[model samples]
Target chain A: MMTRRIIYLDNAATTFPKPEGVIRAVEECMRYRGGNPGRSSHSVSVAAAQTVYSARAAIASMCGAEPERVAFTLNATYALNLAIKGLVRPYSHVVISNIEHNSVLRPVSSLSSMKTDYSLFDVVGKAQGDTEGVLASLKSALRGNTGAVVVCHRSNTLPVEAPLEAIGELCRKKGLTFIVDASQSFGCVETDIEKCGISALCAPFHKGLYGPQGGGFAAFGKSVSDREIRTIMQGGSGSASSEVSMPGYLPERLEAGTVPTPAIAGALAGAEFVKRQGASRIDRYERELVEYMKKRLSRFDKVKVYFPERSCGGILLFNAEGFSGEELAAALDKRGICVRSGLHCSPLSHRVNNTLSCGAVRASVSAFNSYSDVDAFADSLSAVLSLR
Target chain B: MKKCYVSMSTMTLAQKARNILALNKIKANVVKLTVDQSYGGCSWGVETDCDDQEKIRRILDISDIPGYRFIRGKE
Candidate 1:
């Protein structure tokens, strides 16, 4: 007899079974518009460039920015690197949260040695109690030499939503650059670049955006001037090849070499899908599922759930004693339940929560997850607890 | 206060029952009935009167109590 698969609850890492149109768009790009975007005058090149432009427009609209201000990169990490390295000069100070992913941590760590000073505030403890703690930390950490304030819109582990507007206002008042890492909340939550006062935003096409994993982008808000951000990578921008150096422009200044046309096309389709479904609806659905899972997991005597009050995204962290996170995850995997068990690339967050050694099991949901999926997960967890 | 007693191997389940009681703000003592050697876990029975059964059920609803069942005492 064949047993049906129980459920999938790990969507924060990357969304699976992407929308049909997303796959279709990538296939179409590969088949029809397989040319270097912005590099040629042929019809194929124009078609590829148009596809990329369409994607940029969709992303810009999603974040409330001008389409020209958006530049494609390899992934959110790359976009963040460009923003971090390009915006901060030598002897500049930077502020970041402790709960940030390695994508932000590693780059900042390496850059700090090159005469850039940085301060990391522990936001995990405060995130559980107050959402504004992230912004308050950023404001307090600001110094005269502080050039940028980098933040993750939502912590990948706890699903805590940062106060982007307040942080943006603080950055504006202090004449500092506000760069946001929206890899977790880009498609799940509505982000208005103008309202949040964000000077720049870096996001991946995968994960919440529901696209392939190769494409990412950064959008520069109106508050930031073109001259302030230096271009780190200079190469063929496909337009100003006649010039000896990179053009002094918005996107072309940052974009180097041939872009990932297929991934960008897929991202456009994914963003369109999100637009049609509505970000608010997706946010509400995922939040309800997380709340339901938290409520159900709290019943187990051996299970310890960590759910903050103000979190509305998908991720949930918890642990069961007498069992490591890997052991609990393995038990659930036997029942066809999918979850991630680790520090989730944030060792600082785990240290703050005292889960460094065992690391809590993280079950993140997406809009595609159904209520029945949550119920099945709850049942499987119950079975595992019964064995304890 | 009425006292009920049962035997189980581990105190994890007992602690969970206590948490459920605290969440519901109910006052009662939960005693483990027996420990199953095969699973190395225990079976538990709630010892509240008919008046507190509904509140206990509400607690169970929110607590995610595992292997929960009502067992009426032999009168």
Candidate 2:
């Protein structure tokens, strides 16, 4: 059967229909600048290195971070793994938020085998704008062995954001490292390294940044030292090949094995696009879309809305009364409306929301999405509410 | 364009030197020094127009990358 017009609303998974010039940049890199970056010093390699350098500068300038501090990885999952494993060792303690994505939770959990202990708590206080409550939970969780605090800057399910600066301040007061998982919020939110006091940030260029898949990064703050975090993986870093040990510099230290030149090239374009568009613009646009979708969906009698007080970017979580989350999503899909259903890979968040059994539908937006797209989604939801 | 090669003993120094030049608005090209017949070491060289020779030399000096050398163009 022929599908109706498809309106993509699953940008939180990974942005579709990347912005202008991004595809061209990736194609150019694959065609002409395919040399392995920092691996060789041939003419093509020089050009590739330049492309990588330019991308770093773009991301750093946007994040208010130094270019040398940013290291590209396969995706946010790998980046988060590097940060968590690097910081926590055996007998160390860590504090993670309930709002964390699996990317952060799985890595922290893996450290359990290494004898690392972590406390899992909720971000509702921060989500609801209760600053004191937010601080209190963090304060209570910190102990002598608690070396770090990891949190999701924004909740992907509810699309709600916490005050990163305040969270960072709490971590600072306790002398603990602050790691932010920005997989769902990075380019579309305010995440300046200095302002947020983030010791390390893991984000996907393929998500809010609007690049092709396979591009992710972990950018560290100025005070963070390579000596504090040991390398978890080791491979050819191009530099210091004479030495058997991995190079212990910022980018090269964390970046093990062959760097993906084309992916990095696409990410460079994505970073440039976000830079040009400005964070506030993207944030405002996405905010409007989320608010619009939520308002429209709330009008239906059968629609049961599950949302936070205020969300920073694009997302609306809700479920129709008679329809299971998956059933409603399938009906919408038949009508050419795409969205996410189920626990969204964060069972802790679902349990905290008291919807672990019946997951809510997550409809997220992006810069490419228009209000008309939201209208289409709203209409589709209204039609399919009784179908299941 | 006339060219000169700034050769370093290792890859890191070569990359650092090249980045510095690029940040300063100089169009510097990095080439593997091992490809050269006269150069046998596995290092890198930043190739730039001869007009940038003095500027490149100055920046290389300030960067203080140890054992860095310069190879000028024949023409």
Best by TM-score: 2
Top candidate on lDDT is: 2
TM accuracy, model 1? 0.80
- Which residue runs does candidate 1 get wrong by more than 4 Å? A1-6, A122-135, A308-310, B1-75
Question: How much is the lDDT of residue B70 in candidate 2?
Answer: 77
Model-by-model lDDT, in order? 0.77, 0.80
Q: What DockQ class does candidate 2 belong to?
A: incorrect
DockQ of 2: 0.23
For model 2, residues A179-249, the per-residue Cα lDDT tens digits are: 98988778887679888889999898898788889878888997688667678788877655666766656
- Per-residue lDDT over A1-388 for candidate 1, one digit per residue giving the tens place of the 0 to 100 score: 9876757778888887689999999999999999886555467865786687678778989999877678889999999998888887788888888778888888888886788988887565454556466656666777889887888988888766677887788888888888899999999788899899998899999878889989899999988776677787888764334566665556767887888999999999999999999988898889898888888887888888875465668888999978889998999999999999988898867876788887999998987898888888989989998896
**Which CAPRI tier for candidate 1?**
incorrect
